[model samples]
Target: MMFGSRGKARFLAAVEGLESAVRDRDAKRCTRGLREIHRAYGKAGDQEIAEGGARLAALLPELPDGPRGGLAVFVGACVERGADARRCAPAVLAGLAQALEAAEEFCERWAASGGGDFPEPDDGDPGPGVVERGGHCAAFGWWTLPQWEMAAAAMLSHVEVRKELDSIVRARLLRDLRTVTEASGHDFKCLEQVLLVLDDEPLVALDRSSGAGYALRMTGLGDTFQLHTLLADVLIGGGHLPGQAPSAREAAVCRDAPGQVPTTGSFNLVAPDGSLLWNEGTPADIPVVDGVRLLVLDPPPYRRGWPAGRFFPNMPGDLVLERVLGAEETAQWFTQVAPAKG
Candidate 1:
């Protein structure tokens, strides 16, 4: 529903009040402002909600720690409450993305300077530092960065946000997250969760022969063995395969021989142009197309694995497959034996 002029005015006023309350750290005022905003959202239309989102995004970089975090959560809640997040949340995502980049740079510089004087971050704070025994420590930003990262992750978890995000933006966010994780030497729970959400997002699986398409979600199956195992299930479920499942021994052949009998691994994934989808990185690194990734399942000798060495005839098997189907699957394959005749 579209908002009348008065409703729009009320939303603007509520946003302004919330920003002021956050800056003042006035809990009572903050609550009142939040209530007013919620009331406005209930009465306002999608365009007004999006406009309000833009206003909140403008204020995000200037908010203090508690208020910033709280506001991020509130935005996610608004999406959950059916606020047309596809329209309203992209600006919020962009704001968080920019803030995270700025925070990362600020922390890197602060750490390098060894507690020396540094300019305030884009957030307008004095940088994350605290006094201790009459000395300042620059290490505090490392701790503070996680809060912001998690807040961004929480917002991104929404389905609308994930669908609305541009592929380039999503990839950059993942790269930035990895950089921050490597630099900080800290494993963030949010990082893992977000990786699963983004990397394992459903892809369009196309059947070349029949031209049928399916939205396949390979959750927790980015690794080789798990991925193929799930792929086999998908094939069987989709009626692309017949009879009972094959043994692990035969299934292992899918990694190399694409079309040999007695193994469902003969199927290969290719691009829309029928080119091999080679990967030097994990599945998350796969290129996305048209806001979604596509995988064309073709008759085997699956060549999606790592490229072979040029000079050395037998340098090693495909590194991508070796990495995907690690020792764990090898061990499992060795343990299984043909069924004993009764």
Candidate 2:
């Protein structure tokens, strides 16, 4: 997508303004003039974006994915209300808010300078463009990659972060694994690496409790799966979303393990729609509608947050609640927890 340098500048300026609004927690004001937040997921083809894609690629540890961006009618407004560009480490994603604000400013300034708006290019796919309802717009484009989907990239990042944490306390974990292997006559791996053992399992059932958080019932769990469902019901007992999942009589809980310990409440459940459960505390699950894969493992015990006392009895750090799936089903979920799919 070729736009005059002036146009690019304007869009970036607008993004900056948007970021400011987000940091200030002013979403409404930031997106006030924007007619729609045209959230776009690119398909492919473009060099400038390919370079941006390269930076995003760094974000992936093992599998790479597509580029994503959103268009706001008042792009500037949205940035201010929804982003925290300053928080990103590499400075690109982090500067998203600023970039958007700058783009908007550049456009407004250029238009004021009598630089007549460029002729509306033909209906060229132009990759990605932010169209304003009144025939105004700030076009932006990006390409989708083949390495992995955007949702997959988020999954990989979760894995990489988990590994970084485990490396810090590797020695202690190694000793524990050795003890488990020798005493149980099982080829035990380090608690920080159970993902390798159950990569293809399906998630059958889920359970959660304020006391134990989320847990799943695996296919092999057999009757055990039902048993977990029973226990989890008792654990999170009275907590549940008002009118979703399970039903008024049954709150099925996420039944998935934790990718990471929650930040608030004792439990936060991530239902299939990403709605969330009570023990599935805090509910930050990605929108399941997009097919984002999730890895639910027991969070590291030493991790911080909550009261940090007997949150879940016998909750092993490396346990993985395998999802037991058949040829055409999501895996069967079980109570075992594993290391983050690191």
Candidate 3:
């Protein structure tokens, strides 16, 4: 209620204003407004809002030169501002690792500015990217869209920025990452191997579990974690990222995840309460992700694109995880998963 009554109004209005400015091609006005929004974001105290604001600050540099050259300025400024290439610093990791591959392919469509850089590419036409920007989000930096959104949301929960800008930022990051990486590294992953995903995708909730949470592990990768550190390096032609992220032998591992993809798709995660877990690889014996209040997965079988399982309504379109996991296949794949036994 506090968010709605005080924060939501300004947040909604600012985003609407941004949309209008972008639509009208008012780059100057839009950039300025974004700057103000960033400052105001810090004042509000929401984790997402503050995090997104700093990212927006990174994006602002690209603006003065117009959208065409704005991104370069943004990246240049980010390097100067000290974005952490060695770690997944919330303020610095703009979802680059997840989107580096497609972003490079996508940036090829454009030509750069006075520096002879390739120009900016169109918002669409991403290459081999899994978390393509959607109509709902845009990015202000190079990390994953979901992480940025989560960061922004964290800030907003405290400060309240605007309507969830996850989709808006997702789209923007994909666009910028492409531009930033173009001509930087032909073999994106060869440079680094962190599987960063800028996901605007939704969770296919299988169950609406009671008192569910999630198990989130934000591992700090090693210097060998090239994917996360260098993929973006090749795209933007800046932030060389030291050719390695700080990693211990235990921290050094390949960027392998169930969501390793470069297609124009969204990343779907199940709520830790066992609401949704990809019916792949995960051992049921492993505990559920913490604080998972919901699950996400394919739609029901009766409908098009429905999951390969039996489903019942927990909240109309929503269902409890166990109900959907009734699929023998799902149950089999997940060794550690089971409905919360009362």
Candidate 4:
């Protein structure tokens, strides 16, 4: 049976509650959200998401106690279903912070022991955009990186960084795959097949230097900082206006002069009907809304100041306003209608 409108609304609410729970790391909310999912799954009709939600609920208990663990479990549960990565960002950021702190501590100890400067990354072409490869990397190496790091910590006696990361890598020797294969109770030959598949995987790569060219290929443990930083950027870079673009001749008249827009956050301009008029950053680009000339303004500053404003400066308000208003093209078409000049 198809879900009625009320059912659809319930399903949507359940999803929203789940996302909020995940983002806020609210265990009570999560439990409520899971109940909502279980109750609404039949009406939702899409078994995959429902099943995914169940799997996530199952995984939640296995996770360590903390907000990070809850977020991580949420991220893992939603992995197969293309859950918004941003929703679990707090968890990812926490893990990255922990890993980076461990790495830095190791680095400092190594330098104290006369290791000198940490080696620079070898010169090579910039790797593919992290987002393009992040999913595969996260999926494959999710369990692997922490395992390897722990093994490294055990081997070194002290928690010191090793000059030869390759040495640490060599000792492990496809341990991740072997563990998974054994757990699967598959034939040994299946391991070979799995290797072949992994070899051709988009995110996986051969690390000739690290593995001594022993046919070792693995996906990179996607860098959390870089991935999220890029996500923060470029996420809001472009978007469309409420409606389709006006015809070409009509668009020409709406073009704002160059050098009038700010560089970043330029798409904040609002149309007369309160919808954003595309990214054409400029007041001049605003069309006559409801037969009245319109102008866009920057959103008001936070009443209580930003939560982290002391630690991190907010981008200038004037710059933000300019960026939203100065761009040349606008969704507002007023070819037949003239904007009043003051």
Number of clashes in every candidate structure? 4, 79, 98, 10
* TM-score versus the correct structure, for each prediction: 0.44, 0.19, 0.24, 0.23
Assess each prediction's global lDDT (C-alpha) against the native: 0.50, 0.28, 0.30, 0.31
Is candidate 3 or 4 superior in lDDT? 4
Model 2, 134-253: lDDT tens per residue?
122223211111111122222212323223333323344344434423432333122213212122222333322211223332211112222223233433343421211122222122
Which pairs clash in model 4? 261-326, 262-322, 262-323, 266-323, 266-324, 281-325, 281-326, 281-327, 282-325, 282-326
**Tens digits of per-residue lDDT for model 1 on 2-109?**
447778778778988988987887878877887798787666656656666656655665554445545665565554444555554555566556555754564576
lDDT of 2: 0.28
Candidate 3, residues 263-310, lDDT tens digits: the string is 111223343344433323121212333332233322223311111110
List candidate 2 stretches off by more than 4 Å.
1-7, 32-152, 155-162, 165-342
CA error at residue 240 for candidate 3, angstroms: 40
Better of 1 and 4 by TM-score: 1
232-297 per-residue lDDT for model 4 (tens digits):
122222231221222322212112111121112212334434454343122223454444334332
Pairs of colliding residues, candidate 1: 258-266, 258-300, 258-301, 266-300
Give Cα distance to truth, residue 95, candidate 2, Å: 18
Worst 10 residues of 1 by lDDT: 308-317
For residue 9, model 2's alpha carbon misses the true position, in angstroms, by 3.3
- 3 or 4, which is superior by TM-score? 3
Instruction: Specify the poorest-scoring 10-residue window by lDDT in model 4.
Output: 310-319
Please list the residue runs of candidate 1 whose C-alpha ends up more than 4 Å from where it truly belongs after superposition: 1-16, 19-66, 113-144, 154-160, 189-232, 242-282, 285-342
**Candidate 4 TM-score, C-alpha based:** 0.23
State the lDDT at 241 in candidate 1: 57
Best by lDDT: 1
